[model samples]
Target: MGLFITFEGPEGSGKSTQARLLYERLQRLGYPVILTREPGGTRIGELIRRILVDLRHTEMAPTTETLLFSAARAQLVSELVRPYLKTGGIVLCDRYADSTFAYQGYGLGRDLEELQSITTVATGGLMPDLTFYLDLDVEMGLQRKRSARDRLPEPASAAAAFTPHPEWNRLDARDLAYHQRVATGFAELMRRDPDRWRCFVANQPVDLLAEQIFTQVEPMLARIVRLENPR
Candidate 1:
């Protein structure tokens, strides 16, 4: 089977950057790969993303939020991710079921068991073969996010964030405690699955972190390549 990888982290933790760099590196090697993000991959997922991220949706209940994300995940796994993986194509996702565990389950104080049940229904029990978690202090990550937002041509308000990138939604505007819980939750998740989850400090230089990530990914990718075309 093709490699299924996902990146996870707090906001501004550079998950997207590392994922993109790795994707490019794989492409240069002539690997068949597809890079995608959760809550929005297919047409139905994008529409669900609009509701999940819009700042005006402050009235959104935690249950409602979880369900919306699950709905989008169901579509993505069934539509794009599953087919690609079955065909022996690498699929790197920005975020996946883990986010639901971190955000709604841990960050929002929901039941992890219940979340897992929902996630099973969403992704049809598909799990990432490798998950990279960009570790960063909650406050530092938030600061980075704020600074980056401030640098944007458009003002980095709730409205602007949601409009431009749906993932950069009202969550960024949430309370510090909420984000702290997410960071802590991530640690717990990684701890539970040391074999599958690789944690890296996010405060380091991009190239350095990418190198570290590449170090971890290289052997695995090599194995996949070797297995697919055995001598």
Candidate 2:
């Protein structure tokens, strides 16, 4: 069977960049690899991604957003992930169900069990064999994304009703308390699935981070090769 790998983290944690690097490295090693991202891996999913990320849709409710994300995930898995897995290819996903759990359940205060159920159905129980979670501070991630702030909402008044704040970019909109909760949620998930999840401190340089990931992945790659080429 194919090996499924996923990268998860808060915004600006470099999960996307590292996923691309790993995909390239795996291809260089002659492994059949497929690179894709959640909320976008399929045509319908890409449309959903535009709706989810567009700053103009600032009034979207938390529940609606959560369901939209799950919908996209279901389409992506059924269209892209399942076929690649069936071909014994290494599937490198930029983000997956974990994002919904972190962003919607933990950050947006949705019910965790409900979100888990949605994810289970969306993925058809096809969880990643390995997940590399890049941990970083919310402040740092916000700072990294602040440079391109043209599309984000401004910070809203704390006392007034929840108007769209320009800083309400997906990750930036959350209060520090919520972001901390997300971090704790991810940590808890790691503890709960220690065999499948690996936590990495992503406060390092890109090359160094890649090297650390390679160290963990090399053995897994060897095992994949052994299984594929049993003599």
Can you tell me which runs of candidate 2 are displaced by over 4 Å? 148-168, 223-231
| Candidate number with greatest TM-score | 1
Give lDDT per model, in order.
0.87, 0.80
- Tell me how far the alpha carbon of residue 145 in candidate 1 is from the true structure, in angstroms, after superposition: 1.2
Cα lDDT, model 2, residue 140? 88
Q: Which ten residues in a row have the lowest lDDT in candidate 1?
A: 222-231
lDDT of 1 by residue, 1-231 (tens): 888999999998998899999988887777778899888989999898878878778899999999999999999999999998888878999999999999998899999999999999888899999999998998888888888766657655865544735235687888999998988888899989999999888999999999999898888776455224322
Q: lDDT by residue for model 2 over 40-116, one digit each (tens)?
A: 88889988877777656768999889889989989988888888778777889998988888888878889999998
Candidate 1: where is the Cα deviation over 4 Å? 155-168, 223-231
Candidate 2 lowest-lDDT run of ten: 159-168
Residue pairs of candidate 2 with colliding backbone atoms? 152-166, 153-165, 153-166, 153-167, 154-165, 154-166, 154-167
RMSD (Å) per prediction = 3.3, 6.1
